[model samples]
Structures are given as structure tokens and as C-alpha cells.
Target chain A: MKRILAADIGGTTCKLGVFTPDLELLDKWEIPTDTTDEGSRILEDIHQSFKSKGDDHELNLAGVIGIGLGVPGPVDFNNGILNGAINLNWMEQKPIVSEFESISGIRTIVDNDANVAALGEQFKGAGSGHKDVVMVTLGTGVGGGVVSNSMLIHGHGGAAGEIGHLYVDYNRRFQCNCGKKGCLETVASATGMKNLAVHYYESGMTDTLLKNGIEAGTLSAKSIVEAGEKDDALALKVIDEVAHYIAVALSSLSAVTNPKYFILGGGVSRAGRMLTDRIEAYYRPITFPPAYENTEIVMAELGNDAGIYGAARLVKQFLA
Target chain B: MKRILAADIGGTTCKLGVFTPDLELLDKWEIPTDTTDEGSRILEDIHQSFKSKGDDHELNLAGVIGIGLGVPGPVDFNNGILNGAINLNWMEQKPIVSEFESISGIRTIVDNDANVAALGEQFKGAGSGHKDVVMVTLGTGVGGGVVSNSMLIHGHGGAAGEIGHLYVDYNRRFQCNCGKKGCLETVASATGMKNLAVHYYESGMTDTLLKNGIEAGTLSAKSIVEAGEKDDALALKVIDEVAHYIAVALSSLSAVTNPKYFILGGGVSRAGRMLTDRIEAYYRPITFPPAYENTEIVMAELGNDAGIYGAARLVKQFLA
Candidate 1:
């Protein structure tokens, strides 16, 4: 059995796991990440942790296949290099797979976490047997991964699934962090939700936020969504507006990509089908007719571990 | 050398070409179509033409590798059935390839003309040798084709690459025949351009069309664009509005597909670089950075002949 050491490297924490070929999770661990400067130190910590585990089980001495990693932000999957991951504040021409292989004495494969997670969802999660699937991870920013004909759709420069940056309106103007205006991210992402709330507060729809001093500083998107769940009048108003834009994005995506399965993931997707239901409610009636009946929308099933599982799958595909 | 008979069925005319394995244009013929009854008679006409040609050549004609057809509508490429073609009035299902083969005694493959044209552009036209490409055809209604990783991306049931029907605004309540509102097709196609001009005229735009009595429904999209080229005020306003929506569709498609080549085709694309340049001007600013820098947007080279070229290529691939 080929064993893979899969790791998902986020900004604040790094999660790792040892898994068999069949995705049998044998062992798991996590460590606080020092992502700001000297990121290679994290590699040393992982090696030390492996050595400690090796002394206990002699698993490495027995032999293992390889390692896999899923990094945040844009990645050059074909090259296994750190292309440009904003969440990790990493800007490296570093050969990630080569570095990891040098440290662990095993082959390694790496890809963007969103793409890895999408593969995991397709292989063992909500996507199941579906071949064409699009997974949208809603976090601070919107992250997307597209799988078509049983292959991940990472286009030239690994920009294929960057649906977050798509613009809903070309005639109007609004600022986006990717140095664009009127991007779907400007209205449909977590930051976009906050932006909408700010707009609402400005428009005097703040009976709830005014009562709770959320006025002076930026509020977490989670807090705002939670408030809406509790029927906060202002939060509900902002969410409705955001939901419509989300529907527009989804409808547009469906028209272009036409994936059979549209899976929603990450912390924000835990808002469950409520947001998705609203999104579909608005999406179905507005898009071309066939899409309304055919496409399936569901919340992700694998949760946080999807990245690790997908990373392992990449390791198997690349290393084998 | 494997030879394939490639056919492109348009609204007003049908074009036929016999191509060699190397995509050499061996022979060509054209015939005006009679679409009084859902286009079944057109297929019979094509089959009879092939039979007469075969008899004249004194050939046994059993091993005609494959026949590839390019239909003028949103076709379910996987199923080889068509839907949503307004001019043809084909509301019901028709087995285009099978019916043709049954009559002509040739194995056949069929896809929407736009999808085939994308293949033509990618394999033999402007986007030749590009692994990632998206092609748009701007005729009666807008149509699109997607090629990724050197493979045509036809989703389950062949519902992929239907970009024209995408909605940019959920709140937009404009009437589309598909019962949708504010679809990209509503503003991005030749018909859409004419519609925008009418909207402009109705909303009291400066008069130039009134001088030609175009308000009486005599103005074609081509006529309006011609007027715009002469610096006519109302035509430029309507064309610019149409260009903005085309940019919206392009930005959204680019974000998800991240194609290396974006090629524009169809009858309206004859407006040439005028429409393409304007689209790029609008999309360049709004596009997500890094992507905009990498992706190339250009006019399609194949034009009306793209479908036949694409048909030959697709059929050749199947034989290969």
C-alpha cells in the first residue's frame, strides 16, 4: 500500500496527515505556522515531527511513497512552485515539491489548496461520482476549483478557476483587490458581504449594529451572517442584496462552465442551504431554462480534511 | 489519408466541404436552406447531394471515416441533439448525426457550430496550438465554445459552453424567449446590438436612424454597426453598450476558464477588430490582474468556414 504524507498549509496553521492509498487516515497532527518570514523553518518542524513519529512506529524505516501539500493562493500546479499565495504572504520562486522531497527523502507533489480540495470532494466527498464539478470555497475571499471530464481545469498560469475575480457588471464600477473594478468578489465574497453591510449602515439600516457598536471598525463576515440568522433587520437586508449578486455569479458560471455539480464549501458555506437556497431561488428564475432543472447545488461534505485528502490524491497521481 | 465530409448548417444556407487528414480544403459546395419544417428536409437534401457526388465519382464509397456536422444553435454535443435555435423553429428533439448517417451510410459526429468553430480556431485558425481557448460567435444569438487542456469541454449531456444565455443581472426583468431576464445574449449578439439601438432610440437618443426611418424595424445590427463606423451618435452609443456586456461575458468566462486564447467569430464578428478592440478596452481594466496580463484576446480567423474546418478536425480526431 502506498502511504502519503499530506499537508494543508494555511496562514495561521499547518495540518498534516499520514494516509494509505485508499485514503485511510492513519495519523494526523497540526502546528502553529510562522508564515510571515523564514517559511522554510516550517519544513524543519515537519521533518522533526516525522522523526519523532518514526522513532515510535518505524513507519518511515519500513518505507513510504511520497508527500503532498496544498498551499493557499495561486499556485503553479504543473511546476509545483509557490506562484503567488496571498494568504500565506508567500511570494517565492521556490520549487516546493523539490524542497519537500529534499527534506523528507520522498517524492512530493503540490497544488493550490482549492484545487486539491475540489479533487477530494469529487473523489470522496459531496461530488461523489460526478465528473464535472465546481467547488466554491467562501472565506475572506472567494476561492474556486473546476473539475471537468474527470480532470482539474487549471488553465495557463494556474488561473483557470479564479471565478471570484469575475465581474458581474462591466458598465458600472466597484473596486476589487486584484486591482479590478466590479468583480464578483466585490459583491459576492466575505469581504463583499462586509462591504454590503457597510453600505447598508451608511444607508441608515443599522438598528442592530448601532445597538452593538459595530459601527467604528470592520466586522467579521461571520458576525454579520450570524446576526442575519438571528433576524437582525440590517444584516438581513445586506445578506439579501449579497445573495442576489451571488446568484448572478452562479447563473453566469452555469451558463459558461455548465458543471453538473456546484458544491459550496468553507466556513461561510456552513450557512448551509439557506444561502444556497436563496441563491437558487434567485438563480433558477433568471438564468436560461435548462439550467434551472439540471444543475445540482449542495454544501461540501468533506469539511477541512478535504485539502489533505485531495493533496494525497495529487501525491498518488503525481508520484505514481 | 483519412477523408471526412464536414457540413455546416446555417440559417440561410448550408455549406459542405470534404477535407484531407491534413485539413486541406479538398472540395466545397453551398446550397440555400428551406427551413419551413424544423430542418429535417435539409438533412435529406445533404444526404441526396452526397449520394449524387459519390455516383459521379464512380466510387464504391463504404469507408467514409466519419461525418461531422456543425448546427446553428445550442446543441447538446454529448447527446447530438439541438435546442434553442430561434430561426430554425426546431423546438423538438432531432437526432442530427444519426439521421444523416442512416441516410448517407456514414458514421457521424455533431456539435453546435460555435463549439466546432472553437475547435477550428484552436486547431487551424488564430488559436492554433493553444491548449486553453474560448471562442465566441456573434450572430443571431451569441454562442461560445470552450477548449481546455487540449480537449473540448462538453459537460454532462453536452450542456457546456452555452455562454449566451447567462444572466448578468438578477434584478433585470427584461424578457428573453427562454423566460430569463438580462442574459448576456440580450446585449452581446448581433440581435442584441439591434435591440440596444431600438432601446436607445426609444429612450430618446440623438436622431440618425430616424433619418433612415430605422424606427420602423428596418435596421439590421450590421446596418447600425456600419452607421457607428461613420461616427453616427446613436449607433455608437448602442454599439458601446453592447460592447460593455460582451466584456462582462468575457471577464466572467476568462476568470473561470482562464483560456490562453479568446477568439470572436460569427457573422457579426465581421465588424472586425472594431468590436474586439472595444471589448478588450473594457475588459482589460476590469479583469483580475496576472490573468489579464497572461490571457490573449483576439479576433477569430476562420469566420463562416470555421465550422467546416472544426468538423473535419473533430471527425479526424475520432478516427485517430
Candidate 2:
């Protein structure tokens, strides 16, 4: 059985995993990724972890195959570089794959982190049995990855499936982290939810959330969901709108990448049926005729493990 | 260079072409498509065309390699069946590839005509050197196709790349052919232009177009552009707004796909730099940082040839 090392690099943390041929997670570990301090150090840390872990396995495979690293930000996959990470102080283009290969003596592959999560989910989570899928990650921002016909859709610069930027409302523009406004991330994301909560609560409406010491200030989308599940009027208003926004994005996405399964991942997705149920309700009615019945939305199954599994799967396809 | 048969099936016309491996066009023809009377007759007609072409040259290489047909509607690529073609009155699913293959004694392939156009642009048109691209067909209605990493992304059941149905407004909704309202199609499509023009023409805005039979039922997006080029007030207002709306859709697609190039095709795109210049002017300033300098919006070169070229390209990739 070929054992491969999968690494998922993020702005906050780096995940390392060793998986068997059948995708069994044999071992895993996490490391703080302060890409701000020294970006090269993070790459070294990854090498050190690989050396320490692979020695423990002492397992051998054909040429050690390839390592798949899913990084955050716009990446030039052909050049093997992480162009820049806004969260990280990575202004200078860094050659990630070659840097790792110089020390590890193994080939490497890469894609955007959100895309990797989708791949991971397809390989180990809710989309396990599905061949084509679109996964939305609602973390600090809304991210998306698409797999069609058993392959990842990485656009020109490995930034394909960046769903955060899809326009939700062209008429009433809303500012986004990308400096552009009215993007899907401006509404359907955790940050988006919190923003709406503040806007609504500030609009003056008595709700259980405010009475129970819940304020949009110092609150998150997660908190809003929590409040909504407990029947908070304000939270309900915010979430219903968010669900509708997500449905709009979903229908839009379905139009572009007609997939049977729409996988919802990331932190906010933990709300489960709370999000899915609302999304489905809104998604079906507004979607174009044939698309309504042809697509399905489901929560991601792998949880945090998706990144590792997806990284591993990347190796399987590329290394082979 | 191997020779391949390519066909583009549309609502008003069916385009057939014989292409060489270098993606050079050797010969082309056209036929009106209304298969409601007899579906199978279309195949026989195509077969007769092939026979007239006299494929006495090296037509059969290994497998004689399938004909490529681009139909105007949803399609099941894996099964090579036309899921449904609303334009052609193809009510039931038709095995397009098998039908063509059996008649011509060569394997055949099929996909949504828009996707084929995208493939054509990527392979031999304005996006010739590009690997990842999004092609928007701006005719009476808006249609889209996305290609990532050198592969055309056809999502579950070939639902991927339907950008026209994406929602543009959350509050001021405009009904779309897809049953959803505020779709980009409602504002960006040529049909949408008529909607916008009708509103403007009826609102007491006197102009050359209205004076020159625009209100007398001689108005289309084409007439609008011709008038706009001459600085017609109503035409300028309508075309500029359409250009901006199209720009917004481009930004949305860029945010998601991040393709290196956006190939603008179909009838409306013939507006030339008038359309592209307007989009580029507004798109760069309005989109996120990552998109500002990365993607390019160019007119498609394949034009009518995209359908046939794309079909051949699809079959060629599978063979390669």
C-alpha cells in the first residue's frame, strides 16, 4: 500500500497527515503557521515534520510519489508558487513546491485551500460517492471549490472555484474584503452574517438575542446561528436572509457548474440542516427549470479532515 | 493533421464543418434544424453531408475518431445524449452521439453548443493560447461556458457553465427564462437589452433609434449598438448600461473562475471594442485586487466556427 504525506497550509495553521492507499488516516499533526514572521521558516517546519513522520513509518513507495499542499490565496500552480496570502505577509512570490522538494526529495502538487477542502470532502466526506461536486466553505470568508468529472477545476492561475467573489446583488453594492462589494462573501459568509446582524439590530427591532445579552457587536455568524436555533428573532432574520443569499449563490453556481451535489463545508456549515434546509427551500424555487431537479445540496461529511484527505487524493491522481 | 467532422446545432441554424488537426477550417455548411417532425432524419442529413464531402483522404485514423456535435441545451456528456433541446423541439432525450456514430460508422461526441463554443475559443480563437477561459455567448439570450486547466468543466450531468442564470438583483427582480428573476440574462442578454430599450423607448426619450423605426419594431441589440456607435442618446444610454451590467457579470465570473481570458462571443459581441472597452473600463475598477491584472476579456475569434471546432477539440482531447 502506498503511503503519502498530505499537507494543508493555511494562514493560521498547517495540517500534516500520513494516509494509506485506501485513504486511512494513519497519523496527523498540526503546526502554527505564522507566515508573517518568516515565510521560509514555515516551509522548513513542513520539511522537518515530513522527515520526523516519514522516519517513524519507514515505509517505502515508488519515488516517494508526490505531496499535495493546499495553500491559501491566489496560487500559480504551473509555477508552484503561492503568489500572495492577504492574511499572511506573503507579498513576495514564494515557490512552495520546489522549496519542499529541495529537502524532501519528493514531487509536490498544489491548489487553493478552499479547492482542496472540496477535494477532501469528495474523497472522504459528504461527496464521497459523488464524482462531480461543488463545495462551499463558509469560514472567515466564503470559499468554493468545484470538481467535475473526477477532476478539480483550477482556473488560469489555480484560482478557479473562488466562489467568494460571485456577485450576489449587482444593484445594491456592498463592500467586500477584496475591495469590491456585493460579492457572495459579503452576504453568505460568517463575516457577512455578523455584518447583517449588526445592521439589522441597529435598525431597531426587539429580539430574544438582544434581551439575552446577544449583540451583533462582538458577535459572529456562529453566534447568530446559535441564537436563531434557540428562536432569536434577530438571529432568525439574519439567518433567513443569509440562507436566501446562499440560495441565490447556489443557484448561480449551479448555472455555471451544474453539479448534482452542492456540498456545504467550513465552520458555519456545522449549523447543518439549519443552513441546508433553508438553502434548499430557497434554492429550488428560484433556480432555472432543469437545474432545480438536477441538483442537490448536502452538508460536508469529513469536517476538518477534508483538507488532509483532499491533499492525499491530489497526490494519488498526480503522483500516479 | 487529422480531419474531424464538427457540427453546431442551434435554434435557428445547424452549422457543420470539416476541421484539420491544427484546428484549421477546411470546409463548412449550414442547415435549418427543426427535428420535431422527425428526430432521426437529422442524422441522415448529416450523414449525407459527410458523404458529399468525399472523405477519400486519411479520414479514418485508428478509430476514424467520432464526430463532434454541439447542441443547444442540457446534455449528458458521459452518456452522449441530448438531455433536452428546447430550441429544436427535441422533447425527449436523444442519443445524439450514438445516432451520428452509427450512421457515419465513426464514434461521435456531443455537448451543449455554448460549451463547444468555449472549447473552440480556447483551442483556436481569441483564447487560442489560453488554457483556462470563460466564454459568454451574448446573443438574444446570454449563455456561458467555462474551461479550467485545459479541460472544459461540465459539472454533474453537464450542468456546469450556465452563467446567464446567475441573479443580478436581490430586490428589483426581473423575471428570466429560467423561472428565476433578476438573472444576468434579464439585463445583459440581447433579449435583456430589448427589455431595457423598450422601457427607455417608452419613457419619452426621443432618439435616432425611435425616430428610425426602433419603436416601430425594428429594434434589436444590433440596432442599438449601431446607433450607439453614432452617439445616439438612447442607444448610448442603453448600450452603456448593458456594457456595465455585462461587466458586473464578468467580474462575478472572474471572481469564481479567475480564468486568464474571457472570450466574448455570439451576436451582441460583434459590437467590437464598443462592448469590450466599456467592460474593461468598469470591470477593472470594480472587481477585487486579484482580478484587476490577471484576467483578460477578448472577443472570440471562432465566431460561427466555434461549435464545430469545439466538438472536434472535445473528441480530440478524449483521443489524446
Candidate 3:
């Protein structure tokens, strides 16, 4: 049975998985990313990990068809280059795919991590049944990927799915890490939820669980979601505000891409129906008629494994 | 010497054109749309126009390979159905392709006018030589079309490329024709420009050409552009404000679809470099880094003929 090697490389961790030709995951694991040398050792670590996994499973290395990698940055997929990956502390471009292929003796493919995750969901997760899917990951920052006609839209510079950077508010004073003001990420990410909580608390808007949590320095996106789940007014308000920003961004995206399904993933999305239900409520009123009626908002199903699955799926597409 | 017949069907007029297989316009003409009977005679008018053109030129009817049409509303391109084209009083779905094919004895294809126009630009106009292009037509209302990887992106319900409907301002109180408030169309269209002029005039801000034009009931998007060309204060303000909204919408779109070029068309685009120059100025600050550097904004080369040319391009694709 032939196998494929898949890797999802993030800023802090590198997730590796082995899958069969049929796409069944044979094994999966993670290792801390060694970013000490401008991420020069990262590819070497991934290669070593692949060899160790093969040894542990007593599998033949020659039986591996290819390796697929998802990197946390804009990827020049056609040229196999990772460009200015900030998280990995690489300020310059790197030949990621070539290095991995040379070390592992197998052909390799690479793409942006968010795009890979979207492909993962499209292939076997929440977006499996839909050919046109837009996946937004609400983690530390909002990340997005679009798959149209079953092909990922990498745009001209591989910067197509930067949904988090969408400017939602013009009057906002808070600056996004990207040096822009009013980015959707400044209001929709987990940190953005906490900012909303702090803004409300500093405005002296009332006594509520969120206010109390903020005063105690215990306010977090999760805590706010829990309080909202229990019907806390302040927490619900924060959730509604966050959901409003996300819904507006999604509505704007729908008008442009008109995807069939919007899959919400990442940490903040774990708030589940509470988040999606509110998003749909705000979305329906703002989206164009036909798109509003045709598109569906759903939650991610693969969780942490999405990147790995997406990476494997990349290999399948490459081989095909 | 084979040719293609093309029609751009709108609410007020029907534009017909004959083109060589290489897409060069051979001849073109227009007729008022007789929409009295649910657009029943629209197709017949197009047929008559094609026959008369053939007669006038003494061309062989057998040399025409196909006919392509661009309609005002949603289209199911696969089955050639135009769904509820409200502008044409087509409240009921109609099988447009078959009707035209049966009457002209030529194969027929149809698509939303915006999508077809984008294809036209992609094939031989401003967007020519680019595989991924986004075209936004700023007329009475804004309309848009997108081409990705050389194919039109007609979302799930053929509703993709509705860029005009993107919600750009949540605080806006003016409603769009689509029943939504804060849509880009509410601020970026020709009507939207007038509204902005009126907004500043009514706010009691200052003395400017726009104020005088409004007092004389001569205020128009064209007049405002003309004033801005001479550096009129209020007129430039209106132009800047409209450019701001369009830039924001384009930035958001770039984050999602990341097309290589944005082609601005329709009547208002005749404002020429006055409009595009400002749009690019405002676009740079808000767009994601790589996308901002890569995507270019330019005027449509085909002008009013874009729709007819686009319609003809559709036939070329079909025959290919």
C-alpha cells in the first residue's frame, strides 16, 4: 500500500501525518517548530520526522508517493517558494518545496496554511459536499481560503484569502497588527472579542459577567462565550458585536465570491452554534438576495487535523 | 469568413453586433427594447436585426456559426435559462438560448451581462492578456463581473461578481435598490455620487460648483467629474468620497478573490483617469500588502461596446 507524507507547518508547531493512497490517515503527530535559525532547520526537522515515522511503522520509504506541506504564509505555489512568513521569523523568501523534496527524496507540494485548511474541509470536512466553499478560521487572527469549482483561488500573489485584513470600520482607532485600522481581525478574532469586552468595560456600561471578568483581568473570548451561553447581557452584547463584524465581512465576501458554503473554524469558532447562529442572523439582512438564499454558514468538522488532511489532499491532486 | 452574432439585452435597449471569428467587430446597431409583453419580442427584434445586417452587407447566413447573448439578470448558463430578469420584465424564467437558437438556426449561448462583459474585457479589451480579471461597471448602479483562471466565476446561483452590493459602510442610512443599506452601490454609483453632492450641500458646508449645479438641478456624476478635473473643492470631495468607498470595496475583494486587474467600465468611467487615478491612490493604503502591489486598476477599453464584444466572446468560448 502506497503512502503520502503531509505536514502543516505553523509558527509554533509542525503537524505531520501519514496517509494511505485512499486518504485514510495512518498516523499523525506534532513537534515544536525550531525557528532558531530563520526557519532554516524547519524543513530539516520535517524531513527527519518523516524518516522516524517511517522507521517506527516499518514502512518502506520508497513506497511514499509524495509529500504535501502547508506553510503559514503567502506561498508562491507554482515556484514552491514561501514568501516573507512573519510567523516563522523569515523576512526573506525561501525555497520550501525544493528543500523538502531534496531531503526526503520525494516530490513535494506547498500552499498557504489557510488555503490548505480550506482544501482539507472541502475534501473531507464540513465543506466536503460543496464545490464552492469559503472557509474562515477565527484563530489569533482571522484567516480565509476560497475554493471555487473545486480549485483553490491563490490569486496573483498567493495573497487571495486574507479575509482578516478586511477593513470593516473606518472610524475605528484600534490598529490591526498589519498596520491597518478597523480590520475585521481587530474586531472578530479572539483577541478582538477581549478588546470589545475591554472597550465596553472602560465605557462604564453596566454590571455584567463580562464587566466583572474584565475588572478581574479574567476576560477572555471563551469566558465571554460561556457567559453569553448563560444569557449574560454584557457578554451577549460583546458576542453580538463580534458576530456583527464577522457577518459584515462574510456578506461582503459573498457578494464577491458567492460561495455555496462558509465554513467557520479555529478557536473562536468553537463557540459553535452560538457564533454561527448570530452570524446568519446578521448576514441575511446584508447579503445580496440570491446569494443570501443560496449560501450556508456551517462549522468546521476536522478541527486540528484539517491542515494535515488538506496537505494530504494536495498530494492527491498533484498525483492526479 | 465565418462570423458570430451577439446581443447585449438591457432594460431600455438591445445592442446587436456581428463579429468575425477573431472577435473584431464587423458591424453593430441598437433598437429600443419592446418589453411590453414580458420581453416576448426582444428575441424576435434581435433576430430581425441580425437578418437585416446580413442583408445590408450581402453576407451569407450560413457563414454565421453561433449567437451569444448578455442578459440583465441571473442566468443558468448550463441550461441557457434566464431567471426572473426584472429589468426586462421577465418575472418568469425563460429558456433564452433555445429560443434564439431555434429562430436564428445558429447555436446560442447566454450569460449574465456583467459576466459576459468581463469575458469581453478578458478576451480583447482592458482585461485582455490577463487570466484573472475583475470588472466593475459604475453606472446608475454598480454592477460587477469576475474572471478567474480564464473562466467566469458564476457562483452557486450565478450570483458571483456582485461587487456593487458589498456592504462598505455599516453606519450608512441610505438604502440601495437591492433593499440593503450601506451597500457599495449606495455610495459608489452615479446616483450615489449625486447623493454625496446633495449630502454635503444639505450639510451647509461650503460654496462649490456642486452646490451651484444642485441649485440649478444640473448636478450630475459627469458634471462633478468635470468640476473635479478643474479642482473644484466640493466636487473633488465628492469624487474622493466615492473613490474611498470603491477602494475599500476593492481592497476587501482583493483579500478574497485577488484578481490580477480591476477593469472599470460603464458611463461614469468615462471620467477617465480622473476616477481611476483617485481609486488607485485610496486603494494602496488599505489593501493587503502583496495584493496591493500586484493588482492594477484600469479603465475598460471597449466602453459601451464592451457588452456586445463580451457577448461575441461568449460564442468564441462556446465554439472552442
- For TM-score, the strongest prediction is 2
Please write out the lDDT profile of model 3 over residues A1-320, one tens digit for every residue: 58888999988999999998888888999999988878778888988888877775555667888888998888987789988788888889888887877877888999989999999998899988777889999987899898887788877667787889887867665678877778889889988998887887777766787766787887788898998999988788888988999999889878987888899998999998888889989998988887778788988899879999988988998853
Model 1, position A198: C-alpha lDDT score: 78
Candidate 3 matches the true fold with a TM-score of: 0.89
DockQ of every candidate: 0.64, 0.61, 0.65
Give every collision pair in model 2: A126-A301, A174-A181, A255-B162, A256-B160, A256-B161, A256-B162, A257-B160, A258-B159, A258-B160, B66-B107
Candidate 2 local lDDT, B1-320, one digit each (tens): 36777888877778988777655677888977657674546777776766676555445534345578898878888888887777777778888877777777777888988889899889888888888899998887888799887788887767678878766655434678777787778878888877777777777787565455654776778878888888888888877887887887777677667788988887888888887898888787766667546788888886688888898898788743
Query: What range of 10 consecutive residues in model 3 chain B has the weakest lDDT sum?
Result: B52-61
Candidate 1 per-residue lDDT over residues B172-254, each given as its tens digit:
63566667778877777877777777777777784774346464667788888788899889888877777777877778888
RMSD values, in order shown? 3.3, 3.0, 3.3
Give the per-residue lDDT digits (tens) of candidate 2, residues A1-320: 46788888877889998877666788888988867565657777887777766666765435366788888777777788888766567777778788878867778887778878898888678887778888998877898888877788776766567787776655434578777777778877888887777767667865556444434256767778888889888888878887888888777777777777888877887878877888889887767666556777888887777888898898888775
lDDT of each: 0.77, 0.77, 0.85
Candidate with more favorable, higher lDDT: 1 or 2: 2
1 or 3, greater by DockQ = 3
How does residue B130 of candidate 3 score in lDDT?
Answer: 78
Descending-DockQ candidate ranking: 3, 1, 2
**TM-score list, all predictions:** 0.90, 0.91, 0.89
